[model samples]
Target: MTEINENALAKMREVVPESQIHYLTKAVSRDDKNKLGCEQKNGRNVSADGIFCGGYHPKSFHVAYWGHADLTARLLEADPEWNWEPLSVDDRGLPAFDQNGGLWMRLTVGGVTRLGYGDSQGKTGPNAIKEAIGDGLRNAAMRFGAGLELWSKSDLRSTQETDDAREWLVEAQAAADVPAIREIWQQARAAGADVDTLDKITILAQERMEGGA
Candidate 1:
């Protein structure tokens, strides 16, 4: 697990629009089926779930681009001039697929290009090709810092303290002994609580103390 930096997330929100982040933030449990029998528009999506679906995808980034027009759609939506070229080619100058049914896609945006690899071997038939192309491009874009927050899953994004943190706050508040509560603040500061966090702790503790009183 990696540490989540508070400032970095705010930066990602600016660089990548929330419209794109929402898809990356989505999660479906193994038994959840609201999306069952529905295919993404244009097959452009790069889902967190693999072709067949099972466990949820990593929540750090858009797990999958949905729809058939995925790679093209993302580029056009962001920068109309964006397009992709196959990094690997056959003798006929066509896009090439490897033995594992993977392809590398090179995406050029505003004249700059990036190469990303895709694997849709798990999928069968024609759509496999489309999926590979989209996934490869998405993977490459992420490398460009397109979705830096995707580097950390949703759980890691929040600045709000955890249940444990809140528990400590509440416990300290309820403590009748001053030294006991002081110890809580000390522990919290050592754990890297920010000024705002300490303020919140004080406020929460006061409310608890007052309520008990």
Candidate 2:
């Protein structure tokens, strides 16, 4: 196997820029017959226009996602020759689906390759294939840390917790020096700061040190 270049790997793992982030709305039926959950009036049903999935009805929630085009662009930006292919092809030389009706594929970037699987979620025909390809690409890209943060539960902190983390982040960023920033980071960690918060603290410390703050 070819070794992955450290610089290229780092670039591939860099947090995706906010501008490339997008939101998707998913709906869950409140009816008891729905497989997602039992019927309950936990809160009011709401609706919103989804970026790729179209409008959603009440009982729907929004989630952050990176679209297929964005993921592809990022891959190309990280590795000019990045590529992907299905694990197996059918008699007609087309991508083959597994018994579960899902597609398995491999994504290669910076000399690293990983496996990912995707399903159409009941969709069929050409659209199903497209959706599976897109989903599989996202899954494989995640192994390389592309858009990984959005998938992390650490990014799902409650509003109050997020507010507190941001407040700590402001303090860390405003520290007089690297030592002060380190001290703040320690405090935040002891206070049970999430992964995202700790990452920001570490990044700020590195910036300060690099600039001789």
Candidate 3:
């Protein structure tokens, strides 16, 4: 990755700040929030069967691409000379199909300004104009090379729990009975087995029925 410019870095902090993750306290009830620290909710905070650990926290979004407006204002402030232009638009207008457009930014560096481009597409309805605009802008900002580093942080998804969920799935599927499998399916979902894994079990059933095996 091209190193982010020091000036750009400074501007990024002012623009896209890190997400504030407030650590949980007893007042923050377990069912009330999406996230709670591992310390307090240690015993059965997620699954009753112990397959899900709500505290496992996989990838965290420190500075998620804020919607269209904030990003534009932020980038502009960072570089007063910076400019954005719409590069392309979908030929079939909105309501006919989703809006897809390309946007480019002109950012001035030390003494020079360079162009960066981004592409964005969004579903046909709602605040799509705004949505498409933001998508394109964030993509361009990525090339501007400042706040994009927020994505560099990685999280170690809890492997043991994931494996345990898989094991329960295999054993449940072994029963080859609809009711038994259904029970496991619900349990797995509550336990936080990912959708992909859960979908595989459904796929397995479909394959067996189609093959008549």
Candidate 4:
């Protein structure tokens, strides 16, 4: 079982934005400490659970499954512009985290979920439901204890798309400069977007302010 270090969690929160923070917990399977639906911990052979906390993207609101190696490879193969790494796999070669485990944190900005994966095989089951509940509970706990922002399914982007967008934006902004900013501004102005769109522009501007460009 992985250790849940409160100090590490606190530090993680500090690094992550309060607006992007989310929380979820899941039960691990005993039959497979790493697989879904196998009970293995707490002497009851209950599934091992994890607490996931992070941001939600505006595109694909689901980030957990997108982290899967299979999914990441497919996505990257399809688009070399993607700037994220696949989730690490355990000794069994399964993705480090699956839909059945925990609600992994996903950061999303400008319609993308940052660092996460989605399972394309669609092997969801009991563990999937358990994971969802865990995610909800963890999110509630964080919102109650830390005053972080929380959004419903519809309000946030689907986890998968959101995960991709966030990472791409991060990478793109990293290589951005005054010229890039000018382009973004030009595009936004040309589109005559609403306040929210401009707000995203502002956020991107702030990132540039902090040397993201």
Which residue runs of candidate 2 sit more than 4 Å off their true CA positions?
1-3, 27-59, 154-213
Model 1 residue 77 CA deviation (Å) reads: 4.9
> What is candidate 1's lDDT per residue for 1-213, written digit by digit as tens?
434443432332335444443343343222223343223431212232223232333211133333434434545655665668888799999899888888978866544566888888589778888778767876777655555455444345343335546666677767776556667766765554434555666676667566664
TM-score of 2: 0.58
In the range 1-213, model 2's lDDT, one tens digit per residue, is: 687866667777889887887665444333313222212332222422122323334434457778889888888888898889999999999999998889999998889889998888978899899999999998888898878998884255356566988899999988999999999987875565555787789899999889988
lDDT score for residue 57 of model 2: 42
Best candidate, lDDT-wise? 2
Worst 10 residues of 4 by lDDT: 57-66
In candidate 3 the C-alpha lDDT for residue 117 amounts to 51
Local distance difference test, per candidate? Answer: 0.55, 0.74, 0.49, 0.37
- Each prediction's RMSD over C-alphas, in Å, is 16.1, 16.6, 8.5, 22.9
Superposed Cα deviation of residue 185, candidate 3 (Å): 5.5
**In candidate 2, residue 18 scores what lDDT?**
78
Candidate 3: tens digits of C-alpha lDDT, residues 1-213? 343356754674553554421222221122224443343345444333322223443212122234555666666667665555444334653212223344454545323345555443534444655555555556556565644544342112335546765796686668566556667766765665555656766666666567664
TM-scores for all candidates: the values are 0.43, 0.58, 0.48, 0.19
Error of 1 at 27 (Å): 9.9
Candidate 2, lDDT over the whole model: 0.74
